[model samples]
Target chain A: MSEPTRGPKGRVEIKSEECKGCGTCVELCPQDVLLLGNDLNRMGYRAVTYKGDGCTGCGICFYACPEPGALSVYKIKDKALA
Target chain B: MARDTFTKAECLYDRYVRKTKVEPDQVSTHYCPGCGHGNVHKFVAETIDEMGLQDRTIFISPVGCSVFGYYYFHLSNVQAAHGRAPAVATALKRAHPNSIVISYQGDGDLAGIGGNEMLHAANRGEPVTMIFINNAIYGMTGGQMAPTTLLGMKTATTPAGRTARNEGGPIRVVELLSKLDGPVYLERVALTDAKQIYRARAAVRKAIQNQVENRGFSLVEILAPCPTGWKMDPVDARHWIEETMMQVFPLGVTCDRTKEIAPSEAKPVPFVHTDLRALLDIEDESEGFAPNRTHSEGVERGVRLKVAGFGGQGILLLGQGLAECGMGDGYEVSWLPSYGPEMRGGTAHCHVRISERPIGSPLVAESDVLIAMNRPSLERFLPDLVPGGTVLYDSSLIPDGVARSDVRAVAIPATQIANELGSPRTANMVMAGAFARATELFTVDHLKASLPRFVKAKATLAVNETAIDRGAAHMEKLLETVMT
Candidate 1:
């Protein structure tokens, strides 16, 4: 509905191999940005990459990442690009 | 709220036991000889009484030595599963948001089998408080080797002085759980001394206040003495807890969440009861999984992978980095850990399953891709490959170009590539880069967003950012060299 907040604060990073293909992230993303990736990664979790813009920095993504080290957020920086 | 002074300065027993004064009355505590559970309970009850929340609070008792907590605590409470007190607290925190729930668990209960749940609950920032007693031995279970047992300490299980080679090292639970973000308050105190007990009571008071003000998860781990198990006198027991356990689990607030997140300003967050029937789409048990967009919308490209390697191969993070890309792709997923004792010496293997379907188990039976980080793993798991699977092995590690028939094979000098790039650790990233080239697993754009998740918070912000780019390029060279 809105332009996705691409800032790293509230994003989810999927560790492709650790994914068990549970589709938990796809069903749970409130912003609906995470989806399974292509058949290219070593472990095909339909690894989650973004679809379009629409993420808030809310940590729902971080919570739902059951893979522990599989998914987590990074630092948010103030850049001129934004 | 100010600490209002009362005219009578009585002991904890009189003020909190449904009585007007502080002394032993109808409630007979079942603590062992020289056990610290009684003192810890006294401090907690007194704190509750002082706060005037005797009616508004709920107590949760653990299975170990503190099992008979209902005998003394004059409040609504239930005995929970061994090491599962955190789960009960989590449920209560979610259901009864306003109630102040306290979980009083022992070292055997909180730091052993229930270790993961405790860390996760703290990480979730549940509006609850926990009192973890670290006595170093399973007091209720006749002095077994608890997770917090001191190194080289003799126990029922570790008769030979708890060898580092056999039992491994003791887990520092407080320091480990502090890395998470959910806790509003965390402090580890020792009750072995008069000074420390007083300090512990104050910390407990602060933690309870945080809860009353609706602050999220507060944990206070106390190093209490067990004279009977340690085969020492009361004074000696306190001395042991102070000398041995304190060196490992230093007493202090791991995260002073009270300062960062004030509870007075806390409002009751909206609570949503999970609709399991609808979410599971369980019209009937016979139809196992509904194959529709409702449940199976994420992880379109289902890939189950197994990585095998040795300890020095830098292979553990291989599965993790790949899992990040999947998250970047907006896929539904889970990453399971596959580590065991064999990993300590020579061999290590991790099986990861990534898919669009609801995962029944974290264990991956067959793999779509197998990246053997070392020779031993290649020998161990070569036969377990699924049909039409792919193999990315280190050219230097593969013995006979094995599994070229059953699985599509590619050999890359991944570790060499990393050494050439000036970092041996990037070997795994280089392998990921090779997989990226051959598999088209995820676009570089998505992978770009996912790399930062593994960077440590204190620093590595800049090095990690630079490492990701370098990692991507090294594998890109492999793709270019191979394609030509």
Candidate 2:
């Protein structure tokens, strides 16, 4: 599995430094596109990471994540990547 | 190439620079992991941005885990005292009628300590939005049982588990507030799952929208999770809110009258000094009595006078009369009365300050002049007299006179003079006359002119006037004798 910054339709960016590894976004993500990474962030909690593909960019994960800047979801304007 | 559509909310500060402690990341909130406050804060920020209320919003942060709400939202913020968010919000909304005020409070703050404030603010139908986070426990103080704590919920204060008999059932705030006629919208939403959180965001938007439209008080009570306070994992806390807390606090709108009710038309009247005078029925300076020249001169450095006597001896009335006359003479004046419960016989004293400048304190701890109507009055307050201060005692009531030599003591038979004037009640006026002449603060004519303002009975006015003249004459004769 290669880590791609953006999928065909959308992108999800997780600021690892701000994540507390609560798994709220991972549990709430509809596309199963987020997971808690094995490496710990600066604050010593496992940080969330986006899967390489299949991100619908529903933005539910953004709302689910407690930290304000930890997660941001974006819908791609170009459809050709799909 | 992909272009971005959805992004972080604009209402939230880019970096929480206000979070003074820099150890934790400044880009993140101070709330614990999966804490409900963070989600609610995000929803509020998003709503503010959507509604374009960033410039007009004033957030009142309560004393709770979200006390640092000011640090996150890039809006005007005020941190209210514990449980006083509603009161603070009420004042803010009234003072700035054009602004949208939002009071953010927790269960312990809104329901427990500030319950009365919340209820009354709702009852008054103040045009403000309230976001209540009911975590069922005191999250900031460490899992103490709150008023919204569900039955059988074990907390630090409820180690035996909350019993209905001991702790009573949880308070349904939305239901209680729904019964009031003031609130235009009331809803309870939870932050348990994606669906519920979406509903909570909608409720938050609706509540604030109601305020923007001037629909009056709107409250959205969100059943939030406290993972650290509950001693549970973040996911389990969410499950507990869904399975347990939801059973006690059912989700949905408890009351909604947003359609039927009209937008608030009553605007707060801005405070004006002249308007206050008109409201109080006080005439303008041009139409009012002119200032007495002598009194203004005597009040250049201010005068602190203590009057003490038996209650029925008119100790308070004398002080009031002096204060009123001083006010009419264009001096800043204050009268503070202290008395026991008994109406007639109790010991009574009053402090009077007449000043050219504004009086700082009405308490005359040390007096420039002391008027003692009785022996105990003289003995009790004599020590507080400054050196070279004047003492005017009713010689008919206390024959011993003032014993101190350092202060000027003037003996006036005020009660006897009042009896000779045919009314014993006129003794206060006689003393007032002596005070005026002895201090040369004002003339007898000034007292007579102001007498009708305070002295109610029309029949006794003439006798009171005569009593004032006699007292002034007595003081004048004493001064003449001293000069000889």
Candidate 3:
């Protein structure tokens, strides 16, 4: 789980099982925070992953992602996770 | 403490249960990775959520890759035949004027096979939102050249390259539709990048909002990426749309009459005829004769009758009279007619079912009674008669009677009797009279009373009634001899 507790303005979660390694989200992410991981999901395709920090929560990646359930972008209201 | 705001749309199902047969994953769509359909689906779903149209929305999915759109969208879904989404959407919008109807179709489906349907539906100014995904190539059918395929574009069908002379130029659907006076809003957008996708999202919202306002037909043609079909990665496919596809299909609003046009009034409720007698122009005769509730002994299950003859022999009329008589007697009835091409000379047949209980199907594959007016009809339908069933034939026309001994064969010279009664067309009434008496399903008087409902000419009614009485008398005489 790549959770950003280091007080980033936002967080992005990538559901690995539903991702198909299309890299549309990775390429379109303005913060360059998303990447295709080496590990393969159950479907035998590399799934996208969050790079631990630096998510602006612009949600461009979410719109770019083709899979409806693969990406979730959240805007954190507070400085850090409680 | 931090509270996170979720950005995903709620209109999409949490789990796509309908897609279980295609793949094990419930969350994933059947579209290939980076397919433009997924992005468009997201936009539409989010718009539906934002507008609060989830409950009132009816989505018409076209044939092609997105045929399984019903599997993803949680709204009311209707899957149309290939290229027929516009037709379905028009009907849905007309029937449910308050509901938001959206027709989502692809390039090949909308512009190719269903071109005529889409054209006429839009021309009719039906207040329905249509999402036209123009990916340039037929993605679902394995990269075939679509009507919107750009010139010199290499596809499975156009392996070498698409040429203007050979395949003709790509169709700019939005531009073509802009020529029409019907559509209130028309825009062509792309899904090449975040900025273009945002434009597409806005266009989709506006198109749907136009329908919500009842401003008439609105279409958003989205230039979507087809990575798998284009043989490019997802990112490269997006770049290709921006760098190449936009040259052929420019992104812009071709028409915007939404602000000018007033919201259309709700369509009138489809006319229904509750008073069938008034609709059929028949006088109220039900009070004269009460419905006979007494059903025949063996016919408690139902009576399935098959009537067959030449088209001119009034075979269908005979069947209709039986069905109408059954209805008059308070029994559930169905009459289905099957006829060939020619109006008079071709073969004709009808299946009639009347029952004390509700009938399941109108088709009488194995009939309890076979009414044959010609020799061929008797020979063709003889095998389909149930064992110990009754066979009624026109003895004047069919000289060689039914060969089957398992069934009671009653030979009535129906045509000869009709000719004696002064008209040859009343032969069907004679057969109807025989049927009523032979089965004991209804009285001969009931059969005569129902004739005015079907018989149009008033002058021929007397002859038809006379033929029916004569046929019933002949059958009665035959039954008496058997009893003796």
Best by DockQ: 2
**lDDT of each prediction vs. the true structure?**
0.68, 0.87, 0.88
lDDT of 2: 0.87
lDDT per residue (tens digit) for residues B32-130 in model 3: 988999889999998899889999999989989999998899999999999999999988887888999999999999999999988998898888999
Native interface contacts retained, candidate 3: 0.70
Instruction: Give the count of colliding residue pairs in each prediction.
Output: 49, 0, 0
Clashes of 1: 49
User: Lowest summed-lDDT stretch of 10 residues in model 1 chain B?
Assistant: B1-10
For model 2 chain A, give the 10-residue run with minimal summed lDDT: A1-10
Model 2 collision count: 0
**What docking grade does candidate 1 earn?**
incorrect
Candidate 2 lDDT over B129-243, as tens digits, reads 9999999999999899999988888899999889999999999999999999999899999987889989998999999989888888999999998999999999899999999
The better candidate by DockQ, 1 or 3, is 3
Better DockQ candidate (1, 2): 2
DockQ of 2: 0.58
Q: How close is each model in CA RMSD to the real structure?
A: 26.6, 4.0, 4.0
> What TM-scores result for chain A when each predicted structure is judged separately against the true chain A?
0.65, 0.86, 0.87
